[model samples]
Target: MYVAVKGGERAIDNAHAWLAEERRGDKAVPELSVPQIREQMALAVNRVMAEGSLYDPDLAALAIKQARGDLIEAIFLIRAYRTTLPRFGGSNPIETETMTCDRRVSATFKDAPGGQVLGPTFDYTHRLLDFKLAADGDVDDAPLGTPHPDATPHIMSFLDQEDLIQSEPQGAETPADLTRTPLELPASRALRLQSLTRGDEGFILGMAYSTQRGYARNHAFVAELRIGAVAVEMDIPELGFAIEIGEITVTESETVNQFQGSKTQPPQFTRGYGLVFGMTERKAISMALVDRALRWKELGEDNVGAPAQDEEFVLYHSDNIQATGFLEHIKLPHYVDFQSELELIRKLRREAQENIMQEAAE
Candidate 1:
C-alpha cells in the first residue's frame, strides 16, 4: 500500500543546503573565488556569458562553480540576476569599426587591407592530451603582443564601396530585447541574431553543416570574424549625460551570401551578422550562416523547407537550457500524473471485462 510521502518541502530545502555545501566541498580547502574561476575556467565562463546574454565573466564563473559546473544552470542564474537590474536607457549604437580587436580574419579576400591577426587560437594546436598536467598544471605567464592600430576594415564595407554588396541602412530605433518580450514570428535582424548567439553550439553547427549539404545552399563567404573588448555604455536620464557603464569582450561575425535578385531588385550579395558575448568565433560564424539561411524570405528566395530556414524550428530547438529542463523534468515528481493515467486504464479494463461478461451471459 502506498502511503503519502511526507516532508517534501523540508526534504527539498535540506537537499539544496546539502548541495550548496557539496558545491563548496571541504571548509579547510577554502571556497573557490569568482576571480579564480574566471581566471582558471575562462572558456567555461565565456560560454556561460555568451549564452546567458550577460558578459560578466566573474559572475558567470561564480554561477558555474555554484551550479557544480552545470553551464545551463549558470546561464539561468545570470539570466535571472540580469532581470533585477534597472534599465536607465540605451546608448548610441556601438561603433564596431572602432573595436580594438585581438583576433580578426576574412575568408572572402586573399589579403585584406588590415592583415589577418590569428591571435591565440586552438587552430594550430595538436589534439594530443598533455600528460604533464596530471599533478599540477603548467601555468604560463607570457605577456601579450601589442596590437596593430591599423586593423583591417570590414570586407562587406569594401564590397559595398563598389556597390557589389547591399548596404544595410543603420536602424535609428532601438531594437526590442528578446529577453523582455515574448518571441514572435517574422522576427527582425536584431531578434534573429540575439537568439542565435545564445543558441547551443552543437545545434547551430549542425544547422550550418546542413546549409553546406545543400539544404538551403546559398554561397556564403566569411566576410569577417573579429574578437575584442568594447565598452558597454548607457544613458542615465537623471544625470542627463551618458557615462561609461562597463566593458565586455565580444565576438562579431558577418557573412556575405550570394543571391539572385528578386523581381523588384537585381542580382546582389546579401549579408548576415552575429554578435555574441566573449571570444566565441565558432558560434558567431555558425550564427551568421544560419542567419543568412533564415533570410531567404526577405531576400525573395523560395523556401525549400530547410531546417535553418524554419525560424520556429531553429529558435525553439537551439537552446540547450530549454531542451534540458524539459528532458530532465520527467525525473522529478511526476508520479501523481502517472497515477491518474494508471487509474484511467484500470477503469477502462474493468468496463471492458463487465461488457464481456454481459455478452457471454446473453
Candidate 2:
C-alpha cells in the first residue's frame, strides 16, 4: 500500500509564482505596460473583452499582459474580475433601432431602409502580415463616423411589416443573467443567446457549419448585422424610472430561418437572434444559427439530435473558461490511484498463476 502524498497548496503557490515570473520574461527587457498592451495588443484586448463580457480595454489589456498574451487566460482573468463587480442595477434592454450606427449590413436584402453601412470592419482587408507593426507603429483614427441618433429601422422589420417573417414581441421583463446564477436546464432564449455570445468562437462556428451541412439545417439567411453604441439605462426603483447609465458598443445579428408550417399555422420565416459585446460579426452570426437550432422545442419542430439542439451539450461546453479549466485539470497528480490499480493487477495475476500450477501438479 502506497501512502497518499498530500501537499497541494504550497505547490500551487510555488507554481503560481513561477508562472508570474515566466509571464514577465527577461528582467533586462522592460516589462510590457498595460497601456502598451491596450494600444498594441488591441485585438487580444478586444477578444478578451468580448469573451469575458467586459468592455474595459485597459483592464483587458492588463489581463492579457499578465496571461502572457494567452487570450484564453486573459478571458479567464476578465471573467473573474467581472464576477467581482457589484451590480448596482440591471439595465433596461438596449433598443438596437435607437443605436448610434457605426456598422449595419444585411445579406438577405439588397436594399434596406438604413442603407447597410459597413463601418470600421476588417472584413475586406487582405490578410497580410505587416512587419512594420512589430516596430510599434502608431495608429491614428482615419475619419470619425457621425453619430446618427435616429437611424432607419432594421431591414428585417420591413420583412415583418409585409408578413414575410414572423414578428416577435419584445418582452417587458428583465432577462436572466447567466453569470450570476448556476445555469439550469431548459434555458430561456435570452440565457442561451448570452452563453453563445461568450462561447468559444470556433466551437460555435463548427456547430453552425454542422447545421448548414444538413445537421438540422433550417435554411437560414442573414437578416441583419448591426454594430453600434446603445444607451444603457438602469431602472431606479426609488426614482420611479430608468435612466441612461452609460453607452456600450455591441454587435447584433438576426437570422431568418425557414420553419415548417402546419394545417392550422401559416408558413412564416422564424428568426434567430445574437447580440454580443464588441464588433464580432462572425461570432454573432454563428451564435444566431445556433440560437435558431436551439429553438426547436419552442417552435414545435422535431429535434434532429443536433449539437446546438442539445441543451445540456450547448450550455455545459460553451464557455472556454470552464472548458479549459476542466481540460487542464487532468494534468494534476493521480499516481496513488494508478499504483493501487497496478498492485491489484499484479496480485490477481500471481494468484491465478499459483492456482494453475497446483491444478497441473494434482
Candidate 3:
C-alpha cells in the first residue's frame, strides 16, 4: 500500500504558475496564437490529433501550446479532454478512392494511372537550411495545376482485376472500438488497423524498420502512397440519408508484399494497408509495413517470432500515452515501495555479516 503525503499544495500551485510563465517565454515577443500553431505547425497538430484519437485541430493546437510544444503531453491533454466529449454517432466509412489527390506517388510502377503529382514534398530538395527564412519568411505563390477531372483510381485495382493480388473481402460485422473497450487477444484485422492508425508514429516506424531489417521480412513494395482530402459523411436518422458533414486530409498507403504460395493456395501478391489522418506519409508507410508483418498468420505464412508479428506486444505497447503514464509514474513518490526494498537489502547484508562473524568465531 502507498502512503499519501500532504503539504505540497502550495508548492504544486507555485510550480504550475512558473510553468505558465515559462510557456509564455518573454513579454517582448508576441505570443503564439492557436491559429498560427494549427496552420504553421500543422504536422505536429496532425500527430497530436492522430495519437490522441481526436480530430479537432484547434484543440490539438491549444494542447500543443499548453504543453509548451511537448507532443506526448499535448496528446495526453487531448485524450483527457476527449473523455468528456459526448458521442452523437459514428460517421460513414470514408471512401478514400474518391479523395481529391493533392499528392500521389507509386514506387512499384512507373507512370501508373493518375500520373505522379509531387505536391508540396521535400523529397527532391537539398537538405539545406534556408537562411532567408530565418530573417524573412516570405515566399512567392506556388504555381497551380489543373485538378484531375476523373476520380483517381487505386493502383491495387489493377492487380485485383488480374487476380494477381490476394483479395480482401469486406466483412459486414461492426468493428470493435479499442477506445471504448478493453483490447482482447486474437484481435481482428479491423481492430489491429485501428490500433496501428492511432499508434505512436515513432514506435510504428521503428517496427516497420525492423521488418525491413529482415525480422519476419516480407519484401514490401509501395504500390501507392496518396495524400488528399476525403469527405466525411454521417447518416441522419431523421432524414434517412447520409449527408456530407466535413472533409479531412488523410494519408493512405498500400504496399504489395512478395507472393506467398502454399499447396492449397496459388502464388498471389499480398497487401498491407495503412490509412491515417493528415499528410503523414512516413507514418502511413510505416503503418503499412507493420500491418503487413502482422498479417503473417492470416496470409498462411510462418510467424518467425518477429516483434511485429507479436500482436499482444505491438497492440499493448503501441499507445504512447499508456507507455508514458506507466513510465512517468516511477518518477512520482515511491516511498513505501523503496523503503521496503531498502529494508530488505539491509536485512540481507546484516544476515550475511552475522553468518560471516559466526564462521570466523567457529
> Estimated TM-score per prediction?
0.89, 0.88, 0.97
lDDT of 2 by residue, 1-362 (tens): 23445796798899999998998899999888999888766666767888898889889988888888889998999999998898776677788888887888888887777677888778898989867667766555578766556755877878778997766777678777788877887888888888888898888888888888888866799999888889899889899988887888888999998876644447888998888777678888999999989988777788878787898898789889999998987666667878888999999999999999999999
The candidate that wins on lDDT is 3
Candidate 1 residue runs with Cα over 4 Å from true position: 1-5, 25-31, 135-143, 235-243, 350-362
lDDT per residue as tens, model 1, 289-333: 999999888777889999899999999899887888889877776
Model 1 gets an lDDT of: 0.83
The 10-residue segment with the lowest total lDDT in model 1: 145-154
Off by over 4 Å in 3: 145-149
For candidate 2, what is the TM-score?
0.88
Name the candidate that leads on TM-score: 3
Among all windows of ten consecutive residues in candidate 2, which has the lowest summed lDDT? Answer: 1-10
RMSD of 3: 1.3
How much is the lDDT of residue 233 in candidate 2? 90
Number of the candidate with higher TM-score, 1 or 3: 3
